[model samples]
Target: MLNRNNLKVWLKSVSLVGALWVANSALAESPEEKGLRIATERKAADKGWGDSIATTKMILRNAHGEESVREMRLKALEVNGDGDKGLTIFDRPRDVAGTAFLNHSHINEPDDQWLYLPALKRVKRIASRNKSGPFMGSEFSYEDLASFEVAKYTYKYLRDEVVNGEKCWVLESIPTDRYSGYTKQIVWIDQSHYRPQKVEFYDRKRSLLKTLTMSDYKLYLDKYWRAHTLSMVNHQTGKSTDLLTTETQFRVGLEERDFEQNALRRAR
Candidate 1:
């Protein structure tokens, strides 16, 4: 009988074999089909997390190495048959305190998002056309905050490459949204667990705009893997952002109403 750690290793081996089999069996599939299949598998591996809450820290850095930090509370809800809902409530930095952001993602159509400004005491709707703009002076854009929905992009398999010691499948994902600021994105998804290790965003001119790397992954429920930190670097502006999260609490009784627009203003 295998012990806890051995059991984990065995399970991972089985998952790896399954992925290999899937990939090998799809030799006759087109690049688009293969890319979509891999993406579907990636999403399936993270299903049924239900809900979660996390304490987060956002560190923003300018080209001159100047830094500022903002602390926030993040809550997320898993919506069946569609995209997820999320809310972020800022708690620190006197200037940005009491600010909140809400997101409702969808498989098809533009996502709905709103930001609440405590000083103005008003909730501002995020325009779809402006989704590419930076979020709160951070390297991450509003579009980056939206939950991943396979339908949002058209996929094509690029090639295999090793990134950070992990063999990954390189995929080309072109946004379907006409208003999207990006022309396409290149994603490196690890062969193991199908987790994304890195992604490169391309601007409308197909120029590399930024790169995001996810690391410090921790397994939850012995099944799901969540990244503890994300680093986004803007190549053109020499700006960067680091998002760090405390241990996430999964299946935290979060409801849809908890992510409503009104809730943004009420966020503490």
Candidate 2:
């Protein structure tokens, strides 16, 4: 049997150890931690190491039954703690020449977007509310062009589902901002790479509005994985956007200065 003083000391030590363990476990898991885990995986899928440049062709089909094609060139640089900045130049259709778009993604706060039109000779700031609007008359919304930050939405793990013969985790996400037109989104993420293989968007009415599918994945730089094609179809309007990534280059030298408002006008 232990003396009274020794028993008290032993009890105190056990209590301290238990309290420390609980605190450590709580610190290991936080909302930011969960969000960062998902965001990191998404960022890797989008702009991984050695992925320096990407060129894509966008085909837009409107509800009125008109079709248009546009070519875009994207160069990514300085992908580190400060966040990634990319310069996108629109090439094709003489009417839209010299048009450029710039994206500066911040870890916090809304991303800054600007579009420079040759005719106007001025760069226009893209409003956050207009994110849901079509991009240059395409079926793709402005939000689609912007990088998907985990901070923009709240996520919940739904269940496991089969997509393209791969087991995936179905996650339901709700936009955190009022400016977002989508009421909710369902995403299918592959278990192996954590890449989103498909997504479905619901409108303000909570009705299924659009479905996006990604396929034709190719590995780059032995670490980076990219999807060559992404197709989005609007169920309500019978319109669709087909984006084909024709070329991509990785690990090329780029700087934040290249993605500035002043550079937007001269992107081409």
Candidate 3:
């Protein structure tokens, strides 16, 4: 009952509808898959920043508004097939001077961390269970300082929103480590650069515990991006800590040996 022209028109419409359906199906991304993809892309973008040395100032503010400041230097070395290693050496504050902290991050596993106390002349290993504790009386826990690895958390894409006037993708990440201090974290990552703008940490009991905001981002080596200021606020305690980076040098040619435990003791 169909003429040649009519048959051709009918076939074209069916083909068009079929193509559209296929395109829509291909475009649909599950929240979990989308989250993982974003995290992977972010991690990939930050790769190959060989090594770095940074001098930072730590400002601790108590609930009463009292403040104390400490100066420190950090050295970091990128590792292959694993997370990076870092060392933090304190230089100011007579009581805490010569103190050092060493960290070896691992994906989806408990990190190896140590704190070298100059007064005791001994290095204390930070137990996985205690990683949730405060870092030098600051709002940042030991776990909070670990280098982010994609496998460390299971992520879900929450939504998209504007943060600090920049469009961002909101994600919820649950820690994979049993000893992690935070049960989950809600993160806001800039859509353009994949840089984290803010993160809200939930305690083991799933209560909102702290919020960390990173600002003043600067690009280095035409590739890497770094935040000049990081502020962590404790919701329940009304306390906060601000980390201000005074200077940073990348591609310092640091080697793996420099991050060894022995090197932690000899850190200047």
Candidate with the greatest lDDT versus the true structure: 3
Of 1 and 3, which scores higher on lDDT?
3
Candidate achieving higher lDDT, 1 or 2? 1
Q: TM-score: which candidate is best?
A: 3
Error of 1 at 233 (Å): 1.0
C-alpha lDDT of residue 212 in model 3? 98
**Candidate 1 residue lDDT tens string, 1-268:** 8899999999999999999999877776999998999888888988999999999888999999999997888899999889899898888787888898888888777778888998999999976655788777789887887777788889999999999788999999999987888999999999998889999999998899999999998999898888889999999999999999975999878888888887887898
Model 3 agreement with the true structure over 1-268: per-residue lDDT tens digits = 8999999999999999999998987688789989999999999999999999999998999999999988999999887678789999998786778999888887756678888887778889876645788877788887888788898899999999999788999999999888888899999999999999999999988999999999999999999999999999999999999999999999988898888888877888
Write down the lDDT of every candidate, Cα atoms only. 0.89, 0.78, 0.89
What are the models' TM-scores? 0.86, 0.81, 0.89
Q: Candidate 2 lDDT (Cα, whole model)?
A: 0.78
